[model samples]
Target: MDDKKLVKTLFMVMTHRNEQVGLSLWNDNPQGYNQYCQWQTIIANPRAMGLGKRYIESDLNRSFNIPNPRTYEEKRA
Candidate 1:
């Protein structure tokens, strides 16, 4: 089977660490879960999640494409 065919949807669970709705969807529905070959949950900021904060140094959402990454979030980006 084509690798592409296995993933019907790419669920990108970004930003909020406390949010488990996306993971719950992946776990609750076995039939739907099978459609995705890869782990669907994409946690954008592990540091923020670990710290129980929205971000460490800077807002991750706005840190992307930064030339000189000075902050933790910027470095992650």
Candidate 2:
């Protein structure tokens, strides 16, 4: 018999690439950053952030429901 506790992973998705709040939060707290290493954090639109825009083709926040996924944001979804 195996008895072990499972820790559920936290998924922090940066839907809006233009927002730097999360980055600031992580940078401000070293302890939080250490804990964050165990969680899944995804920068949904890296290209959008690089280009200084909210998104490239479409908004990633709404792209998750896309069926065909034609645009870059849709593909990212």
Candidate 3:
């Protein structure tokens, strides 16, 4: 997520795989920023597709903001 230009970001939080979006803070940052959790969470997420930097190149890697919740698009499948 840091490597590519962030098309968007949610300072609060996002969804957890197999669960629901905005269910909870995936993991508080060192400064308590409830972002997309740690780097591991990004890789571990089923939604992440394990693409890493390549994930950024794909359309799914585009920023997904949970603020809008269920209606927004994210390649959850």
lDDT (C-alpha, whole model) for all candidates: 0.65, 0.64, 0.33
Error (Å) of candidate 2 at residue 55 is: 0.4
- Candidate 1 overall lDDT versus native: 0.65
| Candidate 2 residue lDDT tens string, 5-66 | 33334444455766776765444442322322434455667788788888899888788878
TM-score per prediction, in order, is: 0.57, 0.65, 0.18
Candidate 1 lowest-lDDT run of ten: 30-39
lDDT tens string, model 1, 1-77?
Answer: 56767755455443656665565554554334444464444566777677777677788779889998899878877
Pairs with backbone N, CA or C atoms under 3 Å apart (clashes), candidate 3 = none
Candidate 3 C-alpha lDDT tens digits along 31-60: 222234333223223333333222322333
Candidate 2 displacement at residue 64 in angstroms: 0.7
> Candidate 3, TM-score vs. the true structure?
0.18
lDDT of 3 at 1: 45
